[model samples]
Target: MGRKTPKSKEKLDKRKEEKALLAEHTALVNKANSQTNPLSSFPAFTKFSKNGLDVTLDCKRVADMDESLIHSIFNLEKENMKNLYDECSWGWNDKKKMEEMTEEAARYLMAKNEAGELVAFSHFRFDLDYGDPVLYCYELQLKQEVRRKGLGKFMMQVLELIAFTSNLHKVILTVLKHNPAAVEFYKALKYEVDETSPQNSVFEEECHYEILSKLNKKIFKT
Candidate 1:
């Protein structure tokens, strides 16, 4: 190859400068996202009456959760998962995943009722995907007793608000194909199958799950 002309060298230098600036901007954005906390000012307990029952719920980080809370969460999961998946593939007694135990401990949100009963929990994390910051919800489970009292929707609304406050681009989750109720629940909340999901393609018929996401419009309002 021949040596580059001065004009070409100047263009290369400009491209390098632009790339460096973009990298810096991305790093700054990630740092700011990390610093944002949705529960920063949240109260220790929130009181409300739902379905003729007075409820007081509190949120706790996974690291702060005690053994009793963890066990109760697992019990609730076992009870609920059975209704969604077949016994052949369900792993109720399997070891807890690292994400559930320690790796992403701070991201887990456990809500307990006034009587200190574990009522619901959500596990979520901040992620960067498709060139945007996203909040990925790995799990959201509610005890059977609280199923239709608007608690499920209430928890999800809280998660959406958290995503908005944390500057996340969207909230994303996956539902098992066997669970039509869950699919409908998410649909009712305006979550749709993501365009990028594998199931969106005609050839990917073997996919066993659907990924759903809702973009955070609060970020655009400003």
Candidate 2:
């Protein structure tokens, strides 16, 4: 082949740079997945004590978690989200939600009260979202008794701490627009709409969910 033009060569170089960045992000996620517990490095964060809540948190893979505990978590999600989910285009499906909860990459940050009762939990995974490694929070469900008592905020802080410390790009989660309380809770945490969040358009129906994210400014700014 004849020698390429400067512009063509620059384009090739840009593609190579993008490919390398994607590979790096994939590796970061793999490294995070290999860990038994992301919270191990931060022992102080494993306990929440305040607002009439006393709970100990632990991170475990679904494979390692007990079946009964998984069922409890599923029930909690169904209880807290079924009505709100039914309001959206994506109606509630028991099988689908349970499957998502037990997906191979799924990990749980579980909180148990003084009597060892399961109270609140966050389902999260380390994956490359839009080509950037992120801790995608699939679910954050708390029992009604534990709501508004600061435990939820504390749980999010723990997720952020693990994500940033693991070198992930950000912690992202989707909240339903109709769930004003959830929207306000994330707002209080300073999470903003992510670039990948969808918008209404003539081509598609309006979206009921908003993707919110908090980036690790120490590393992946901009």
Candidate 3:
């Protein structure tokens, strides 16, 4: 091929730049469209019977949750997270951030015992990241006393069920590297670091947390 003239080369480069910009814009639009409004379809509450214990599961818009209740739950987990993450790195004191997560676009799943005390809770959102629809789990926390009663696994199963029913491609979450037990727990449920995870792109650099995901098997069925 002959060497391109300066004007021809300039035109080709401009076209290439335009194409790249358009592709990026298209990806953003797709991601925005993938987000779901969970409150529109999910029930207000559901009940479960596990090991003879009666548990009630309820979903609430973040803004609707009592401020005291939200503070109390976060306080309950504060110490646990401190042990797993740097004290300064934890955002527990950032009330505004918490409020943002609990807003209308988010979903809170509260698990109550037969006596009506809160036993566990999970905060999640239906998000579109990088052109894929994901059920992103922001937090899953249980009272220390209730940790061994299988509540965590039960709640996760419920979350996965919701993801599948809502047509999400996968359930995604982040686990602190210092929290090996949490990592193992997710591993038991078949969660693995995603191929798109930032860890996969870096060269020998360790991340503070691992972005793990489990595909929705139902989404693939014919």
Best by TM-score: 2
Lowest summed lDDT across 10 adjacent residues in model 3 is found at: 31-40
Residue 166 of candidate 1: its Cα lDDT?
Answer: 67
Point out the higher-scoring one by TM-score: 1 or 2: 2
Following a full C-alpha superposition, what root-mean-square deviation does model 3 have from the true structure?
A: 5.8
At residue 207, candidate 3 shows an lDDT of 62
Give candidate 2 misplaced runs (Cα > 4 Å): 220-222
In TM-score terms, candidate 3 sits at 0.72
Residue range 1-222, candidate 2, lDDT tens digits: 889999999999999999999999999999999999989999999899998889999999999998999999999999999999899898999999999999999999999999999999999999999999999999999999999999999999999999998899899999999999999999999999999999889999889999999999879666
Which should have the higher lDDT, number 1 or number 3?
3
Q: Write the per-residue lDDT of candidate 3 for residues 110-177, one digit (tens) a residue.
A: 88888888778888877765656777888888887677667788778878877776667788998887
TM-score computed on alpha carbons, candidate 1: 0.76
Stretches of model 1 off by over 4 angstroms after superposition: 1-37, 42-45, 82-93, 96-101, 200-205, 220-222
Candidate 2 pairs with clashing backbones:
none
Looking at model 3, residue 139 earns an lDDT score of: 86
Ordered from best to worst TM-score, the candidate numbers read 2, 1, 3
| Order of models, best lDDT first | 2, 3, 1
Clashing pairs in 3: 62-102
